[model samples]
Target chain A: MVCELCAVAKKEVESELLYEDNEIMAVVHLKPAIPGQIIVFPKHHYPIFEQVPDKIIAKMFKIANKLGIALFESLNCHGTNLLINNGVAAGQTMAHFSLNLIPRKEKDGLKLQWEPKKASEEELQTAFLMINEKSKELHPDLFGREEKNEELVEERGRPKEIKLDKKKENYLLKSLKRLP
Target chain B: MPEEEYSEEERKAFEEKIKRMSPEELKEFQKRNCVFCQIIIGQIPAKKVYEDDHCLAVLEINPAAPGHILLLPKEHHAIMPQIPEEEIGHLFMAAKHLSHALLRGLKCGGINLFVANGAVAGQKFQHFVIHLIPRKESDGIKLELPQREIPEDILSKINEVVQNRFNELMGIKKELVKVETKEHAEKKKEAADEEESEKKKEETEKTDPQEEENEDEKSEESEEEKDGSISLDDIASVLNGGR
Candidate 1:
């Protein structure tokens, strides 16, 4: 169940270790588009960008913002690209959620190379809506079981078998029991 | 401050009002200020699929991918910091089921969960909600990481601490979502009924004579303008010629 991204995520932390919190992590990009092209990610390993919880996602963005400020002041190019590629067709090469904060300059040329197409107004509207409606369906809970081998192949890669804490589990169980 | 006192009649009136409220009113009251809450309440409409007592899952108006759904707490708080423990469980549980529905129902290629806790964190919704974004390999979403090795101890520690917190949070969310969703499908149906009102409103407006008159006038005005109708350009030409 070795996803390339997860293998890399699990392999080891490298030079991009700008910041690391329990819930969040930041690193410099491997193939940076701009000079200080840093990308920040949540350690939780949410498979897609949208499915990450609001709280965790917020924290990740806060870290991203801090990095954005850093890149703006220290690196001093022009602006930064806080890019996130959601799916394969959208240009996603990795499985984990990340915000690519690539520093930008006016002339340095990094274009998305977008070619907008017409979808036959009505059909285009339907397609426009289809993206949101369908994505709404595929939630991070897609791989629900605490651990699944296939999910490991699919999502954040099998969460490494870090030791479980009884106290935490108990706390979760008790809280969940009171859900109603 | 002491609880505001209500006389018997007042209390009775309040009960009556509650009864009269129509789920729309309750939902308005339920959400303090979240636009997403407004979307759920039919003040605005969203493409919704999965719903339960505790929460509703809807497609994001602005989507990052093909299957991006916004998971909202039916009852609104500004953010997770404001949500009660019971609510936390309720939300995630609904999210879990909705996610499954997405995978099997929609046949999504993959799924992701997202949430924003605060303003600095890109939380566009004032009312707390999580986003469930579906994925395709071509979407180009990945976590940028260091190319070199991170110490095992550091990684282990990060995993240990985060998992404990995540399990706690996720566990609570699962419970709440499961418990509340099952209990309130009937209430949710009542809410759905309000959308019928929205559709009826649309139908009436579509058929309304005044609306038709306005459309006719607008069309006539545009046609005349297109057909060399009076305009500043004509006046400017007239002025130039006179000069």
Candidate 2:
């Protein structure tokens, strides 16, 4: 519900529509956490950042980098935050996906409020171990990516069946609540 | 009119197409029209390029190369990011086969398989299509990737950033599979679908940050050669012309 940005056209008023193209739109965030806050948004309204295709995501950054540099030069800012909130639980107030460019200056008095929760040596090791095992358990089918085109041609001959596993489904739901 | 204005007509036409779908409808667009979906349903028609129980591939009508095809799941979903570890392996295995087949089918050169997710990345259709842009040296296929040397430290940071994103996608995949709500599943998938592109961006950034900068600078002078952009011949011409 939050990706109202895509449907919006800046009509040379209200907020500045910095850039526009077939794949994404770069617009000035009306409520700038910093004076030059901009959001590089994909034209399509995908709910989470990952669900959108990879190519578009790549291009968005390519443009964003350009804009980031422009924001750096034009605004003469110190640092920048290239951020996207993934899900509702992850402080994602809006369902629509986009990246935020928060330009930082010396004394604007804005901070991310990130307090480090460092783990002890053993705890950190165990955490790393568990995550490593999870990494090894990777399934190629996990992302539904196809590597080549001939297979797509060959696929022309097969029947489509979308599969969803119940156990992992539950595990995933439980996991989202504690997203790191 | 603003000084650097884009076309309003194109944007409006584009908007009309985008608005027709509810998110639920958008998710189903692929399942309903996807060749794999059709193959599963025994609808439409296709010449199978490759197949396994979990995934498959088919020919693209409008091919970027001679053996252009699409590799996808037998079960339809848009560009999803995180998948089960096993499923990720299988998908890669499917890709391996397609790469070989592509070698067989095209007979000439390299593979440039990529997916364009959102409209901003030029995903002309809503079906989460991956463009398996096959490249042949003779065929003049070249990707317009900028080449530059990134600082090793910066590259390391980028690697860490991508790795984190990759994990985030994995988590997202779990979330999608769990919810059973089409919206939830689709939403999570959007984030994962983008990983390939982002990783590639990092790759490009690593290889040549200057390429994009060069392309942008040269756009005005070489508008004629731009359509024929990303060709080895074009690169050679530019390289030779530079000297």
lDDT of 1 by residue, B1-243 (tens): 136999999999989988888878865665734566677678876666555555667665556654556777777666554565555644544554455444434444544555544333345656777666555545554422223333333333222232333334334332112222334444545554565566568786554565456457655654553443333343223212321
The most accurate candidate by TM-score is: 1
Candidate 1: tens digits of C-alpha lDDT, residues A16-125: 35566677766655555443456677777765543565556545655555555555444344554455554443345565656676544545544432222333445335
Interface RMSD of the predictions, in order shown?
16.5, 21.4
Cα deviation at B4, candidate 2, in Å, is: 54
Candidate No. with top DockQ:
1
lDDT of 2 at B74: 60
Query: Model 2 segments beyond 4 Å from truth?
Result: A9-15, A136-180, B1-243
lDDT of candidates 1 onward, in order: 0.50, 0.46
The two-chain DockQ for each candidate, comma-separated, is 0.04, 0.02
Q: Candidate 2 at residue B115, lDDT? A: 41
In model 2, how large is the Cα lDDT of residue B163? 29
